[model samples]
Target: MTSTLILGGRRSGKSARAQALASTFAEVTLIATATASDGEMAERITRHQADRPAHWHTVESPLYLASALQQADAAGCCLLVDCLTLWQTNLLLAEDETLLARETDALLAILPRLQAEVILVSNEVGWSIVPESALARRFADEVGRLHQRLAAACQRVELVVAGLPLTMKNETGTR
Candidate 1:
């Protein structure tokens, strides 16, 4: 199994790049984490849905991402997770105080063992100005650290900007 991590700023085409890569596989399952909390977001989600192939399976994974991945994984299949930042947001806003730590640990533990070709998309949010709220700052810190760990686990890592993807590390076919 090969795992890839794709990071980029908003609208930088990281999700599109992930989608294109996953398209190489015959079987694909997309794990969508964002929730349509507002009308604008609902429209964005709809547009994304319209972009994907109808036959490609999609799993709405808000909190239990590891479990969702585990259930969807299959040898020779491709699993595309279209943004970890929203997943982080969901955990942070949830009532369960320990949800973030628990799920984070679970995902970290499971990534390397998954049998499918896994592509994870996340925003590189540390580039922006420091957030005003303590919660936002905490999120920045936590996500930055999580990116580091994910990079180590992933065989390939990419950074997309201005609709271009720059390979950060690639270890495909090495294992």
Candidate 2:
């Protein structure tokens, strides 16, 4: 089992990079976290769906990522999570801080136990200017923290910029 974290800003091609990596495996599963609450988000989801290969299995998991990962068959499989930012958004909307902490802990704990190659996509929002609203600031802070923790747990960490991936950490025997 191996875990990798791909971090970049919005439209930084991180998701595309994850897809390319996932394609190398025999079986691929996409854990899409985005929810279509508005027209713009719906269009974005449609575009993402169109971009994915027909053969890859897609699972809509806006919440309960730990359960989803636990249920997935990890052996010889590649699991790609599109972006964690939206997942964080969903958690924040719940207004239960305990749920956020619990979910994040569960996800981090399960990564090491999985047999599949896992690729986690997340937005690097901390590099930008501080957010104006309190909620936005909290979200940015939490996402940044989540990225840090996940990156440490992952075998490889890549930072994508302008469609280019700059490897931060790549363990031995990982192609």
Candidate 3:
């Protein structure tokens, strides 16, 4: 699998970039990690769903991301994981604190085995000032660490800002 990790702040065009890359494949399976827990979230989810092509398969996996990838992965297909931060939140809220590390470890371990082209979108939470709340701070720290680990595993790493993508790492070397 040709793995690419897209990191950016909110509204940085990470999803759009991932979608464009995935569209180049013959088949696409989108592993959506977001859930509509409230009205605004529902609206956002609806908008995203509408934006996607009807032919692309969507899998709602607020948790159990590794299993979702295992099931959706296929040769000659692209598996686009839209936002890993939400997945981390899901794991942090749904299970014991240890679950986050366990699930993240599983995801990293499974990446090498997946047969599909993998494009993962993640928020760059560490770029801003430290969050006020303890939980928020912890989330930011975990997400930052996760991005570092993912970048190491992925063949391509990009930082999207102002709707532009800056290649940080490629097959040749780390940019």
Model 2 weakest lDDT span, ten residues long: 65-74
Name the candidate that leads on lDDT.
Answer: 1
Per-residue CA lDDT of candidate 2, range 1-175, in tens?
8889999999999999999999889899999999999999999999998998999998889878977887884699998998899999998898677888999999998998888889999999998889999999999999989998998899999999999999999984755
Q: Give the alpha carbon lDDT tens digit for every residue of 5-66 in model 3.
A: 99999999999989988889989999999999999999989988988889999999988889
RMSD for all candidates, in order, please: 1.4, 1.0, 1.8
lDDT of candidate model 2 versus the reference: 0.90
| TM-scores for every candidate against the unseen true structure | 0.97, 0.97, 0.96
Runs in model 3 deviating more than 4 A are 172-175
lDDT of 1 at 57: 98
Clashes of 3: 0
Evaluated at residue 74, the lDDT of candidate 2 is 67
Model 1 CA deviation exceeding 4 Å by range: 173-175
Per-residue lDDT, model 2, residue 174, is: 58
Which residue pairs collide in model 1, if any?
A: none
| Candidate 1 structure lDDT | 0.94
